[model samples]
Target: MKMFGLRLLLTVFLLVLLELLVINIAGILPFIASHKANISDAPYMEFITDNLQHPIESSTHMIEEKNPLFFLGSGAVVLFTIYATFFMKGGKGKYELADKYGVHGSSRFAQRHEIFKQGETVGVPAKQLMKDLEASMLVSKGEK
Candidate 1:
């Protein structure tokens, strides 16, 4: 739920766009059905019969308004409600938690580095993990 707001915005935009596409396609099918004309050597309008989208506006009428934007908006709202409520959530922040913590954090949380080399700590734990190895080893020896 980190980017819940962003997700809602994107989902709403996409769903509304989808609704618009469906509605427009429903309205525009007749024009596509009509302009069965095409380009071909077989005279005016017979040989190229199978060709789609003639792009002529002679007999095409404007898209009819069967479904209003208000209804479309309402439907989009319902869709978004369903989406935001349950559909997209992934098992209670499974991926979100994994991503929020650095990817290396999950695997390696070094606590008091026991610097082991060649199967042993060489009876020491500080020198190898330090930048100034000689000084660190002396400090470790002094501490011991």
Candidate 2:
């Protein structure tokens, strides 16, 4: 849970950073456009004047030629972040641990007719889990 919280925080932080980068760059769009087009290039404006151009411009006259690949790439990144942060589940579906283990079971009640499954096992304690593992390994080796 702590790890998940930390990951979510980091994800949010990255999202904010990306948004700030876009907005800050957008904020100085006019200046960037002015400078790149050999206009009155302002001083102390390197913060927004990356060589990488954004299509969303500040002004019309000083249009800085934009790289569509960069825009598309960043847009995709932002879109993915939003989806992963808000829409995606904690670990189910596309990010399911059960999928990794090839487990066909779903912990959800819907797997049953409406609420309950026919052959669901009760939750096992940790000690029982260890014992089960040992028993399963022995059986697999034809010793049990």
Candidate 3:
């Protein structure tokens, strides 16, 4: 469980770093947009720049919409996180041992029926059949 938590944290950190790297490479860094209005321009150029003051905002929106790689990476991370949380159980299944031994659900019922059949064939009570089976199992294990 501790290992799982660590893996989940590492996955989130790597995904965040990937997002930041993608945003930087796309030249849509949020700091640049937030600070664009603080940049100084020549007084004579200010008149022409007034119409362009919101260009960074518009371009950032466009980049966000058009950047397919960013969306793909984000989606992959979300899917992987969900899979890790819900499906991946560190190589163990919910019924791993039960399934391996055919000891769950219909299989368990089938095993009981098989034991009943064996008891009937041998003309013995269920308790005697069970004891005989147990003794045989112990002998087999000792032989192994």
lDDT against the true structure, each candidate: 0.49, 0.59, 0.58
Better of 1 and 2 by TM-score: 1
- Worst 10-residue lDDT window for candidate 3 reads 42-51
Best by lDDT: 2
Question: How well does candidate 3 score on lDDT at residue 117?
Answer: 72
Q: Give residue 17's lDDT in candidate 2 (0 to 100).
A: 63
**What TM-score, over all chains together, does every model reach?**
0.33, 0.32, 0.28
Q: Which candidate, 2 or 3, would have the higher lDDT against the true structure?
A: 2
Tens digit per residue, CA lDDT, model 2, 1-144: 998798789788887667546555444655556578655646635545542254244222123446443455468768978787777777566545543433455553333343344566466799999999999999999996
- lDDT tens digits by residue: candidate 3, 22-105: 444343344345457764532424422432454445336546667565456557767766676567667867576554455546
Clashes of each: 0, 0, 0
Clashes of 3: 0
**Over the full model, what C-alpha lDDT does candidate 2 score relative to the true structure?**
0.59
Candidate 2 TM-score over all chains jointly: 0.32
TM-score of 3: 0.28
